[model samples]
Target chain A: MEFNSRIPIYLQVIDTIKKQLVTGKIPPGNKLPSTRELAVEYNINPNTAARIYKEMELMDICYTKRGLGTFATQSEERVGEMKKDITMEVISQFVNQMEELGYTSDDMVKEIRKRSKR
Target chain B: MKYLQTENLTKKFGSTVAVDGVNVVLEKGKIYGLLGPNGSGKSTFMKMVAGLFHPTSGNMMVQGNKLSILSKGEIAFMPTEAYFYNYMKVRTVGEFHEDFYEDFDTAKYEELIKDMNLDMNMKVSALSSGMAAKLKLAATMARDAKLFMLDEPLNGIDLIARDQIMSAIIKKASEDNIMLLSSHLIDVLENILDEVIFIKEGKIVLSGDAEEIREEKGKSIVDLYKEVFAS
Candidate 1:
């Protein structure tokens, strides 16, 4: 994936892994690639890839087992919460963009309803 | 221990100082990018570090030892241009290194060459530019040296070969080694560099962790390089 130059790369890494999780491409309890493997795949420092895991683990998106590598969290509730959070983030950007385009909340609601009818 | 250190290192060729008063510290386990435009002294500094050229004044230290025979054994440098005898075959070069360097690994060199899909039977003059680049990188990475300096390893390599070469370099890197790669390909190096030192007019113009620099400047390394060297 081509990362944005403006944003920090670790955050972009987190976004990619989270996107994979939410999309079910990497199912819960699945073992993700090791940091070294991630580094090679993305052509990043192994330290940076390790940071990606550390960030995810802090969010409960993934957990590590002693002697074993990291695995995606198996908590359905947490996954559902994450899904909602991602949805809200996208919706926030969309609404903010529409507001800037001279659309009121009511106008957005009507437009959403009309679009939903299709 | 600091993997490599230069104390006001200076190198003068006649009236021109190729590398001037460079002071940098490279620690083990880190991948550093020595970036600059042409004539910025990137290669000159690397050559000094590699012991290919003598400094006119000041000094450098490798593992607390001055630049000497022992330090030469500890540093592996792959210059931009490929240097091989016309009659030398692919495997012959591997054997040459194996005989010359005590740290060279024949098995690893063969494995790398095979992985690179290069024929060991072909003469050095017959291989394509990409193949030769891969061979040079593979040979250097096969060494168990403290530091590896690659000067423009991606100079004429294609996109697919760039990935292959980068992967090889990353594989050889460890917590006990430091790899310093110089390139004008800032975009490609930005992703892999742990630290970056931007040189201009034989001086370090900017030096920092790459991601933090990006966040702070709101610009990519390429953009920063252009801004720094804009003429």
Candidate 2:
């Protein structure tokens, strides 16, 4: 994935993995690659890869088993909540941008209604 | 743990001070980008660490030992210029390193050679500059050393080959060794650098964790590079 240079790369990677997890692209409870493997896959620094796993673990998005490697969180309810959180986050961003463009809430609803019918 | 530490390390070419009192502490399991423009003392700093050039002042310690012959064995230095025999085949280069460094892994060399798409039968002199760069990187990275110092590893290489070289570097990185790569190509090296040291006119001007620098400066390392070197 192309990264925005201004932001911390680990944060971007975390979001990417979170999206993958919520979308079922990386299925729940599935094994995640080792830190070194992830570094190679993303072409990022190995230390940054370790930090990514550490942050994910703290957020409860993933957990590790000694010598068995890290796995995605298996709790379906947690995954559902994460999906809603991400959806709201994205919608807020869109709403803010539309607000700047002089689009009201009714206008946005009408626009979405118009586009979905097509 | 500190793998390499230098205190006021300086190098002088007669009256010209090439490296001026560079003090830095490098730890194991991290990849450091020694970033600077050409003639910014990056090479001089690396050579001193590699034990090729004696420091005019101060000293450096490698794994708690002063820079010595034994430390050279643990350090793998890939110079910018091509340093290969014209008559040697691509395979012979690996064998030559194997004979010189006890830590040289022949199997890893062969795998890197294949991954680099270099023919073993090809003559070293016959390969293009890009191929030679790849050859140099593969040879240096094949060494199972405690410290790996590469000078301008991405110089004179195409885009595709750059990706291959970066992949090779990422594969060689581990928690047991320190990899120091000097490059002016900040954008290409930025993502893979755990820390970045910016050297200018023979002195270190700025140094910090890569991500933390970006977070604090509100700009990428590339932008910071431009800001630092802008005249």
Candidate 3:
């Protein structure tokens, strides 16, 4: 995945995984790749991969089974919440950018609706 | 767990000091990026830790023991320059490393060589600069050392080859060892660094967790490197 150099890499990876989980790319209760595997896959530091798993565990997005491996949360509600969180985040960023360009909320809604029809 | 610690590590060449009273602690289970411009003492500092050059003063401890012959066995160093004989074939080089270091794993060497797409029959002199760099990395990483110090492993390598090299380095990283890579290519190395040490004029100017530094400065490590070294 392409990363923003300005942001922390681990946070970026975490967000990517969250988006995947929300989209069912990583299905509920599915096993996550081992930390080393994640590191290799993303070309990131192994330590950062470990931290990603740890942070996800703490956030209830994933859980680790002793001697098995980490798995995505099976709760549909949690996944649904994550989807909403991501959608809001993207919308807010887009809105902020449009506002910076002097576009009003009405203009944004009108433009978005016009584009949706196309 | 501090795997490697240096206290007032200093090295000098005649009247000029290459590494000035620098104190640093490196822990296991992490990869550290030593970032600096040319002639910033990055190589000098790594050479001292590798035992190729003795510290003019100060003490270095590796895995709780003073830097000595025993510690040397646990440290694998890949210098910036090609150290192999031009006459030697790639296979001979692997055999050579196996003969010298007890930690060198011949099987691992073969695997790495194959992964890097280097032919065993190819002569060292026949390889391109990029291929030579890959060969050096494969040879050095074949050893299961406690500390791996690679001086500019990414230098002279192409983008695709760089990804291969990075994957190899990532595979070698484990909880029981510390990997220290020195490279001025901050953008390339930033993602894989657990911590970053910015060196200037033989001294560490800034050092901290890579992510924390980004969060604190609100800039990328590349930007930070430029800012730190800018006159």
Candidate 4:
């Protein structure tokens, strides 16, 4: 529940749920934690947690039912769709950062592979 | 929506310019820390925004509308010093707020009042510093305002009471509200602040995402204050 300062919190919340999905900590159709619970766990304002949930709903990553909590929305097939979206975005950021650090794509790939092996 | 904004806001006291040329934009549904040393113009700036003091120049806006004498109800400003009529009981303070703020949540006030274990019959003058502070906080949080400005909210409360007050404050933040708190206790607010605005010598010296400032500035906010305000 630790929050990062550099990025917007809503985006982080989205990424956290996405990570949970990929890691199998939370599966499709599983109920997400309540906003108050998340707020207390993270020591964040409840409003921020609510905003995160609202944004996730907008992205089709989650949905809410009246009188029920929010749930992960991506089906097993759509899981791959989410993965592609996240992977491309993450890769773009990594590539840009590596370029700024004077590393080529081959070097970046080599370093990432080395890291993965560890 | 940006719940609050200040345009070239300046406040003067006699010959001294306590606040000068401050421009601020605070979006709704977030918490902001206003950090400054004593006499750095933080209180003065907030006072102007709260309509407690008139700005010598510039303007303050709440929810995209300029704050005027007519628009005071949208803001709830809690001053550092607690004041109430000496003869009045604690319950009277709650009742007063209920009468004043149109959005006052009476049920919430009663619940918080019960949680504090405050005696409704206790007179304001008879209560100790910590008790008075708690009462003030309870009343302030009970209001359903668009913006909440708390100045030095933790000043005199003990550590245990401090935690309770913090939880109370956290509970108050909802999707419809924003909170601006000024405190000298950097470590207490270390993890709570979404963003921090640092003031020095009546001007904004630094302001940004709190964690980014900590990581990039190579120091905690306390250290930054010491360095920036160091003689």
The model with the greatest DockQ is 3
For TM-score, the strongest prediction is 2
Tell me the chain A TM-score of model 2: 0.93
TM-score, predicted candidate 2 vs. hidden true structure: 0.96
> What stretches of model 4 exceed 4 Å from their correct place?
A1-33, A47-67, A70-118
In angstroms, the error of model 3 at B169 is: 1.1
Taking the tens digit of each residue's C-alpha lDDT, what string does model 4 give over B113-139? Answer: 776667777899998898898889888
lDDT per residue as tens, model 3, B190-217? 8999999999999999999999988999
lDDT of 2 by residue, A1-118 (tens): 6899877899999999999999999999999999888988898998889999999999999999999999999998888988999999999999999999999999999998988866
Docking class of 3: high
Query: Which pairs clash (backbone N, Cα, C closer than 3 Å) in model 4?
Result: none
Candidate 2, position B31, lDDT: 95
lDDT of each: 0.89, 0.93, 0.93, 0.80
| Fraction of true A-B contacts recovered by candidate 3 | 0.94
Off by over 4 Å in 1: A104-118
Writing each residue's lDDT as its tens digit, candidate 1 over A2-110 gives 9888887888888888888888999989999988888888888887988999999999999999789999999978888888999999999999999999999999999
| lDDT at residue B146 of model 4 (Cα atoms) | 80
- Candidate 2 per-residue lDDT, tens place, B1-231, comes to 798899999999999999999999999888999999999999999999888888999989987889888888999999999999999999999999999999999999999999899988899989999999999999999999989999999999999899889989998999899999999999889999999999999999999998889989999999999999996
Over the full model, what C-alpha lDDT does candidate 3 score relative to the true structure? 0.93
Q: Which residue pairs of candidate 3 clash?
A: none
Question: Which 10-residue window in model 3 chain B sums to the lowest lDDT?
Answer: B61-70
